[model samples]
Target: MTEPQAYLNGAVIPFSEAKLAVTDLGIVYGAAVTEMVRTFAHRLFMLEEHLDRLFDALEYVCIEPPLAKSELKQICERLVEQNAALLPPEQDLGLTVFITAGHNLPYLGLSELETCRTPTVCVHTFPLAFELW
Candidate 1:
């Protein structure tokens, strides 16, 4: 069976291949903002509202995401559509959206930092696992 999919930056690829740099500020200093939104009957729940909060947090932290809210929303929906087919009808998914504070400038040095101005954006999903509840 094919692995599920995830969104990293502007690409949608197999979830297993989605990776972040070791020097990412999120890993080094935990400089990231995240959001979790679950699905109901295979549809996103309160996606707009969730995006509002996500963007708000990003703004508060002064992290400018690479994509606008509309673009991000479309990506999330596409990811969900791609992944949902792998699950049973009764199963749902929990969507996770996160944006990190880009690279660790000091670690990467000034020249490399110039090319890494954009924050890292990712959206991935996992089965709801209601049986555990």
Candidate 2:
């Protein structure tokens, strides 16, 4: 079978290998937080504003990112670079910030189990499918 063209876990990948606990809080309780931003001319036009909003969402959800702003920015840039070949010249890019609260093992049908938070950070590219201008 062919693997996914792109996948990332703190790095870049061209395979479909990702680990997610079945009882993860993100899966069980559906606890997720994210931010979306668009790109134009191969650049994130309002990166600062998008990041500011992302930080606000983290504050609101109480999830502390492990990396500084610069690091995250690099990741986002990499996503664009990796996916650039799949994009059209006139197409814009989109970025997403998806974080989850690890996993919750409460209903794993076991009483002696505990769940921990496993945060995931993904910087991927998507074409502008929904826009109003």
Candidate 3:
């Protein structure tokens, strides 16, 4: 099977390797806000707006993302290029930004280092599922 491309944090990843811990606060506390960036002719449209919204969500919840928006734009561009071959010349691609606070067990929850206030950003490519029709 062909290796699927994924952008997790700042690295290019295999889709199979885009793994997250089960104990993540995003899962347990639903402490995550997401942004969906649709593509226009295989390029992301209004990416800045989507990014701004994602940041707004984080700020609203008081979670600071480890990576700045500039860093994220760089990653997003890379992900698009890495997966360019898979997308049609005229087709659109879907870029999703998901950031959730990290998880901490009851024992270490009090520590700032282990606190769930820092946001974890995970970016990935997605196909246009048929369900939207």
Candidate 4:
């Protein structure tokens, strides 16, 4: 079986490689927001509602995601399809869509605000442990 996949900053990559830099504001200042959705029979649950709340939080925080909600929905669906294949028919996945407050260049004493100001967007999935929940 192939490795599970994740969406990171507009790219689909191996889940293991989906990482954020240490200097990211999400890490440094805890400036990040996330929404979690689960699948049922490989179908997303209340996806539109989840996105609505997520976008609202992003707006309140003044962080503009790099992609539109439509595009992000596509990515989430694709990820669910790809990652869900790795699980047994009875198992489902929990998807996490998160956005960060870009990097903390001032802490690193870097002047490339243009490059560092782009928010980090990621969508990842994990098999749900129903027993634990």
Candidate 5:
């Protein structure tokens, strides 16, 4: 079986390869916004509402996502479709979208002194695991 894929900063790669650097503000300072949407019958549920909430959170933190709302939605859908083959017939997926305040150059001592301008966007999905509930 093939491993599922994940979207990391505009590229889709194997889920295991999707990683974040230590200098990223999301990990260093917890400066990130996230949203989770569940699938019903292999279809996304309330995606727009979730996106709205995600955007609102981004606005609250002053972080700008690289993709606009429509683009992000399309990406999320594509990601879900890409990983659908790995899912079981009876199971649904939990899609997660997270945007971080990009890498903190100051943390790496680059001297550029920029903050939250280039956000890191990631979209990934996992089985719903209804048995665990």
Candidate 6:
């Protein structure tokens, strides 16, 4: 089987290479927001709604994503399309978007104060297993 691809920051890469630093705020503080959208008939279902909730969560957490709504949507669609080749006819993909509050300076002891740094953006997909349902 071919490896799935993922969007990490600005690049599309293999899912195995989508690594986050151990000190990343999302890992240390859980300072991140995420959304998951599933595909139906190889098309995204309620993409806008999922993004809306993601933005809402980001707003609540004060994290600003570098990409706009339209751009994010485009990326998601592109990724889904790219990974469609690996999906079985009966299976769909679960698309996920995760935005983290960048690096954690406090964790590195670089600063006594904390601030919201550049956000880490990642978009990835996985095969949805209906058998578990």
Specify the highest-TM-score model's number: 1
Residue pairs in clash, model 4: none
Candidate 5 backbone collisions, by pair? none
Indicate the worst ten consecutive residues by lDDT in candidate 2. 1-10
State the displacement of the C-alpha of residue 7, model 2, in Å, after optimal TM-score superposition: 5.8
Tens digits of per-residue lDDT, candidate 6, 1-133, equal: 3888999989999999999988788998899998999999879999999999999889998888888999999999999988988877778999999999988876766463343367889999999888999
Better of 3 and 6 by TM-score: 6
What is each predicted model's overall lDDT from 0 to 1? Answer: 0.91, 0.64, 0.77, 0.92, 0.88, 0.89
For candidate 4, which ten residues in a row score worst on lDDT?
107-116
Residue-by-residue lDDT tens digits, candidate 4, 45-131: 999999999999999999988789999999999999998988889999999999999889886666778757799999999999999
State each candidate's clash count: 0, 5, 0, 0, 0, 0
Whole-model lDDT for model 5 versus the true structure?
0.88
Tens-digit lDDT track of model 2 for 1-133: 1222333446666534555567666677777677777888777777777777877787788876656778777777766665655767788777776667654656554452433544556555677765564
Query: Could you tell me every candidate's TM-score relative to the true structure?
Result: 0.96, 0.73, 0.84, 0.95, 0.92, 0.90
Q: Which stretches of candidate 3 lie over 4 Å from their true place?
A: 107-118, 130-132
Candidate 6, 98: how far from true, in Å? Answer: 0.7
Winner on lDDT between 1 and 3 is 1
Q: How far is each candidate from the true structure, as Cα RMSD in Å?
A: 1.1, 4.1, 2.6, 1.2, 1.8, 2.6
The reply for model 5, stretches above 4 Å from the true place, is 111-116
lDDT by residue (8-122, candidate 5, tens digit) is 9889899999999888899999999999999988889999999999999999988877889999999889878878778777889999999999988777665645543578889
Give the worst 10-residue stretch by lDDT in candidate 6. 108-117
Ranking, lDDT, top scorer first: 4, 1, 6, 5, 3, 2
lDDT of 5 at 8: 91
Candidate 2 error regions (>4 Å): 1-7, 15-21, 105-115, 130-133
In model 4, what is the error at residue 48, expressed in angstroms?
0.7
Candidate 4 Cα errors over 4 Å, as ranges? 108-110
